[model samples]
Target: MIEKAKDLYAQLIHAQELVDNSTRRKVLIDSMRELEASGVNCQSCTGCCCTFISNSMQTDGVQTLELYIYLHDKEMWNDSLISRLNEVIKNNRLDYEISTGQGSSFRRTYTCPFYNSGPKGCSISPESKPFGCLAFNALGKGVSAGENCTSNIEVLKQREDIFENNEQRANVYLKSILSLDWDKLPMPVALLRLHESIGKIL
Candidate 1:
């Protein structure tokens, strides 16, 4: 399992490198426009399946929520927040949901429920999981993936269209996905499914 995890990690790094190349994202909207023409459905891409999410120790609220589930199931959480998260889950409360960041992006009202503000740690999701952990399709060169992100289908497809060459696209795509370091974040609604995924994986 660890070897499998390492392989997954390597794949993520390759994608991250692509994203960091700048040559791919430098074109900005032109790439997006090209992908928009590709007939790919963001909702159906599922590239995120190869991805997982991780957080630093300071993340809280939704971040902690997700972490708690991860810790408890994986037995990774110490005597820290698991008990508290359990209480929250039992009570259907979200006190862990605190306001993070300032703007909608940094402080976007949404965060993963498993995020832990106190320790700032993340409970890693499994690889066979669906795609959010892998990719994000934010507009422009402004967006960046963090850790454990697989690769956004939209972004990967856009790489192909913009490069217009399979070999180059594949290389660039690998770099882009690795650039995120699997740091791509999964949207909230998608996060809601983690509990079930954990159940299946654990």
Candidate 2:
């Protein structure tokens, strides 16, 4: 699975090199909308998935970082949020490495910094969420995947596949554009790296 992921990452990067920034952003936005339209409503779930951190289960770091960059470019990234994210990374000790059989992994448990309990959901716009978050139902099909979810299993699966495909491509694009490796880092750590890189360039 790790080798396959790397191969897909490479393909994604190669494909993005042919596209301009505007086109790439459009693709991301359009893909996000399509995923959102799949009827996987969170309702009052209050970020159930975001509440936990697991070594065995986690979101895609590369895709999350790409969303961060997109928001940063749009001037949506604020100092308060950046500071909060950095704090979360620090508190969780996200910088350390854990070794999986396949490779190094980062294992820690903490509420996702992007989760906003006041809103009972994510602080970021739905369109800007990582593909892993977007595809949760399709990929995991947990308790939330019951009748409460308006999306059918087939639809959810299709959307998940699409999101994953886009994410692989986006990760490749981001790796090439940002000159970063997108293998196995915790989400917060990846975000911190991205934040630092953006700070330097700015």
Number of the top-ranking candidate, with lDDT as the measure = 2
RMSD to native, candidate 1: 16.1
TM-score against native, each model: 0.23, 0.58
* 86-125 per-residue lDDT for model 2 (tens digits): 8876777666656676765546776687676542366665
User: What residue runs in model 2 are displaced by over 4 Å at the alpha carbon?
Assistant: 1-41, 53-62, 73-76, 118-120, 137-170, 199-202
What is residue 28's positional error in candidate 2, in angstroms? Answer: 13
lDDT per residue (tens digit) for residues 1-202 in model 1: 2233234334433643323223433444344345446632232333222222231112312232333344455765444444543443334332233445662233123334344332213235522112233233423322234322333566556554864343344434433433322222233322233332333332
- Candidate 1: stretches off by over 4 Å: 1-75, 78-81, 87-110, 113-130, 144-202
Q: What is the lDDT of candidate 1?
A: 0.35
Local distance difference test scores for all models: 0.35, 0.53
